[model samples]
Target: MSTPTSSSSSSIWVLSNIKLQFFARIRRFLQSKATRKRCEPSDRFDTAKNKTEPDNKVENFETVQVTEKHKEKEEEEEEEESVIMMQRTVKMLHFGSWEEKEVAVKEIEKLAKEDVKVRKLITELGVVPVLVSMAVSPVNSRRQAGLTALIHLADGTYTNKALIVEAGILSKLPNTIDLVDESTTSKLAELLLSLSSLANTQFPLASLDFLPLLRNILETGSRSFDTKQCCLGALYNLSTVLENAGPLVSSGVVPFLLEVSSVKEVSEKALATLGNLSVTLMGKKAMENSSMVPERFIEILSWEDKPKCQELSVYILMILAHQSSLQRKKMAEAGIVHVLLEVVLLGSPLAQKRAMKLLQWFKDERQTRVGPHSGPQTPRFAMGSPVNQIEAKEGKKLMKSLVKQSLHRNMEIITQRANAAGESSKLKSLIISTSSKSLPY
Candidate 1:
């Protein structure tokens, strides 16, 4: 008997796309029939009728051949599907031209814009170090695209916050803040904005040593006005995260802002940011010590077009309102009332509300100075409305209550107003006391 050939053996058994088994098996069967004197398949099967008659519309021979071809085609299709599935299972890396990169960026943006996908992609891509490297690349376009992608990744998700912070993204902030060169605007500004959005995150902003770096940017005279504006925006956002960011802000930011305001060439954003940060830090104790409020802030009160600057003046007055009646008397003596009244009258609803609040805080500042009502050396009260007496009796307590509400309603607004108005380290007390619950007769 003849042996089965490898090719026929492969074709005979559908050995998972391995060909040749079927032909081998057929050859073995034929040899066995010949050796044993068995009838041939053609003779046993009536070969002429089987080969020539039609099974359906076609001849039997053609039908059988077509059926076998169809089975092979199906098997090939399944193999192709398996290969495609394997390709999808692997992590994909894309590289291409600027246009292609932009298309990829747009696709990522589309995914991220969906909100749900942003939260998802951050978790999946969190461990990929290329994302971080791209964010810090020397190439501005690549760097911006990376940062924009990262901001979406971290938006409002605490899980993502932990991941990116652990990935050393926070460590890159100092370098971002230090980029004062004009050519880096697209990259640095994008990075700075991303860092700013992290303000509400749990990522320990103070630990990054960002304050000193930001202070360097704000205080350095060699940088341009645009750089200063960017630094101030970052600083303003950062102040929300940092509890006692007053001294750094106070030591020189106020003076720098005043200088910027005086310059015809200074960017308006720089001055506006300066004003915003001044108001944010106003009520903190450290800021009070910085003594940032003396004269220049008083000067901005008169600039009619700069409503933001005027708002800053009002905020400073509100913080300094914490000083004793003698201090208010001193401020009034220093000509603060004129500019403050201007702020009180201008602006939209939020501005008007802020102005009224500051007005209330300023009017009630009498409690800061109290001698026994009958003492011979007692400071004479400033002549004003009955509100002054009510304020002296209940102002600090009421101011403290208002502070609690402000903290609850929006700590950011109060903080920003304080910083922009130039209140350095002074923060209004956040603690609430039950003592004010029942008015004492």
Candidate 2:
């Protein structure tokens, strides 16, 4: 009995100790679960924050692309609008009333100035013909507006120039140019000048029957200064066409040009046209037949106002003097030798050179005529006597003085060339020696 009681007590004590250890383990596990639950929210918050930043960046990138697309769309719309406006303006130019046409033309001129597309569009719409009609309108204001519009259109575009020419504008130019009013003629001349610039248009212009009208206005002296200038400019431009050279000379262009060559405003252009006309054989013959004399050209050479005019006048004279003893003798009588000497002393370098060449030509020709071996000879009166020897001696003295002057002038130019050549030779030698020393050999 005592052994059984002892075993039962031992069992009871072991069960209590086992229950206490189980409770302690359960408390520790609960504490760990609570700590993990608390930390989970903070960790998830950090992950969500990181994901939101990239999402924001991606959204911003998409927004930028969308903005660019919108900008492009807006620009395209504006360009389309501008094209539509231009097309509308071009249409209005055709069917509009006089007042409406005037308004439309004014607008057309403005648009034409801003863009080449507008000019091409106006031309394609056949507005140039209408403009030409209005250019000759009975109403002065309408006529002026039409001319002004045409001028702007032909300002820089060859297409517009061609369109204007093709619209029968050249056919009407003669009649319109004959208008008695100074203002009318001025504008007409301006248009003629513009049309004459193109190679293809030049023939049509030359074929016109208005050369007499142009000459009349230029010579009449009744036209305003500006009108005369415009007419002069048109003639100058027309004279550039070689085919027109004959008609220009026949229409009295040479005499009028000579008459106006003294006017400072027109002198340069007048001389230039005469110079161009003299290039053609036909033109030279016509000029020689005209009332204008060679003495006028010699006088021009002496003018101190314009050096270029003097230079060009000398050049034209040089061209005329070739192969024409009559012209040469006339020039010599006009004191051309003295004038050339003055040029060599005081004119521009180019003028000086030309003058010297011409002088040398004269000298050579004199030597050829007199026979190179024959020294200066005495002139005989009707009888081969010494009565005219004094006259002959004076002529010889004059000839010697001219030769001496020419030699002195040529020596100065030759010395300059020699010095320049010597310097260049020294420079070349220095360069060669320097290069030679730099080479390995």
Candidate 3:
């Protein structure tokens, strides 16, 4: 009986301890689960919201959104404001008082310069016609303001430029440019420069009003060279059209160009126009008529520092000299051959090439020269001549021989230079192998 009671009591104690350990393990698992849940965002929000049960628990159901679409709304607002401003500007430009019109045009000019799109846009508002009309306004300040606006409107857009011409700016020009001051004259010249591109198309830029105004400004010694350069640019553009040549020459542009091209400041532009005119019959004839032709041009060719001027001058001479004996004789008498030799020695490559070609013509003239000869002629022998015919002829032949040899030597030097320039062997040999006979004359 005693052994049974002791065994039963021991078993009961062991069962109670096992139950307590199992409950502790369950409690540890539950604590770990609670810690992990609290680490989540929703659980943290719930814990922070309220210590009062489910009533104070937080749940946010508001739908969230990114608000970047406001830019489209802002652009729409800007567009509306721009339209209102343009309408106001156009109204003020069209029917406003002189002061209002002046203000409007300046605004147009400023707007046009901002963007090409703005230029095209403002042009659609009919600002060009009003600006052009104001260009001819008798009031000098109004005129300058108008011209300034048009120049900006016509800046880089071809369509805007075309619209300006189509607005009859040509017809509206004041007959007397002298009525305007130098500042207004300069502005007008700049406008013409911008509008000169119309000459390249079918548009008629050679109206009676156009060339006269250009000539007036260009001829005025009081006008600055900057203004003159702008006028020259206009003249050059107009001269590009073949039909404009007759009127250009008839306008007495040749004499003025000859006078101005001598000045180094405007020489290149004036010469370039002369080069264009030289291609036309009237232009060639007009230049030939000028006492300044080969002499003025020959003087210009000596400008080594002004290489482009030299090039243009030589180009005009080439045109004038081709198949024209009268001009060539005048050139020879005016000491053109010496100039050509100088050009051959010291000039741009294109200048050198052109000079050599002109020289070849003179050389051919020398080789085939008969009674009244070519190259550069010496003084003639009278009937009772001091120079005996045999002696003179022999001396002439010997001098020709020396010249020929000197030409051969100079050509050899040129070949050596070509060699040093890293030219191809075939070209080098072609130059090197050339005999004196192969030289001009």
Candidate 4:
């Protein structure tokens, strides 16, 4: 019933509205799909970037760890190289030209001074035998270098000293001692002294004809002071063993020591060696027979600058005093009692004790001589008893003379000590009072 134009217009309006709504829906759907694609790719890219970041961090951590390990390995290699270098230096001591050998030995000496480990290494490398060979070489410079190296090597631990001894250095050293110059001889003697410090080394040394060599060196006036000191030191060390005592006495060491007993440089050591030698019975007898022994001991005992010598000389005299009655008589006749009494008053405590013991022994001996005897008895009322009186008178005279001489000697010493120490009045009064009241005679 409506008009046709109005209806048509209404139908067209409805169609246009439907078309616009449908197109808007289609455009919105397409735009959502495009946004979804873009967001998915962005999420994948962010995920890949996160994964790559950790991998890079792990790679950096591994690089740092690997670098530290590499550095540690380098340090180890360097330490090993140093040890190898030290070993090569030791080995270079042999199988070289004279100059090269000299250089090698000096280098070894340098290493030897490093520490005990290097010294033991040098010993184990069998360098000692080659050094011994080089020590006896014809070239003076090489010989000196070899001896110097041995000196340093032997200055190590006991194992090092034994290594040198086992190397047959004792046998080779005696012959070379005479052929070398004074400097080399001194070094050799020093080496020997070091070797002799260990126990049981002296026997082989003596058997290797070293005793005579040492005696010759000591007796030679032309030797260096260091050589003489070293020789005396060696002898002193060797004579400490009781078995070597007799051999030393018989090998003319006693005479040589006595001859050099006055040498200021070696006198103390010489007296010490003699004291060691006198520790045995055979040595005691030898010393008792030597007139020079008591005389030298007395001289040393009176020295003001050498208190050690005084103590040692007193010790030797005490030993000799205990040997036999005849020896005691000889010591007393040699005017030893006054010296012993003086030392009892003025010497060190040990010396004082020894001097007192000897004096007591002398007193006991005198008492025994004058005491009643259990043997066959003689009547005291005999007319010829004048003989005993005369003998007693002579003994008193001898005793008085000894005491006077001792007093005079002590006064001189006291005066010297007082003047040196600026204590003249106090010491002189003290000595005067003590000597007056303390004379046992």
Clashes within 3 Å, all models in order: 46, 0, 0, 0
Worst 10 residues of 3 by lDDT: 60-69
**Which residue pairs show backbone clashes in model 3?**
none
* Tens digits of lDDT, candidate 3, 1-441: 999999978765664465445445545655575455434544455565566545423223111111222443465557556655666777788768999998888778777779987787677656787888888888877888889989998898878888888888877786556667889988988988988988887665646458888888888899999999999999999898898898889888889999999999999999999999998999999999998888999999888779999999999998888768788879878978767765775578899888887776665454333233323333355677655555567755754564455555566554565466564463444455344344333
Distance from true location, Cα of 166 in model 4, Å? 1.4
Whose TM-score is greatest here?
3
C-alpha lDDT score of every prediction, in listed order: 0.50, 0.69, 0.76, 0.70
Over 4 Å off, model 3? 1-72, 202-208, 366-441
Each prediction's TM-score versus the true structure: 0.46, 0.66, 0.70, 0.69
Error of 4 at 74 (Å): 7.7
Q: In model 1, what is the error at residue 49, expressed in angstroms?
A: 43
lDDT of 2 by residue, 243-296 (tens): 888788877678889899878777888889899999899878876776566888
Candidate 1 residue runs with Cα over 4 Å from true position: 1-119, 137-145, 155-162, 174-183, 201-206, 216-231, 241-292, 306-309, 324-330, 340-441
Q: State the displacement of the C-alpha of residue 215, model 1, in Å, after optimal TM-score superposition.
A: 3.4
| Reference-based lDDT, residue 433, model 1 | 30
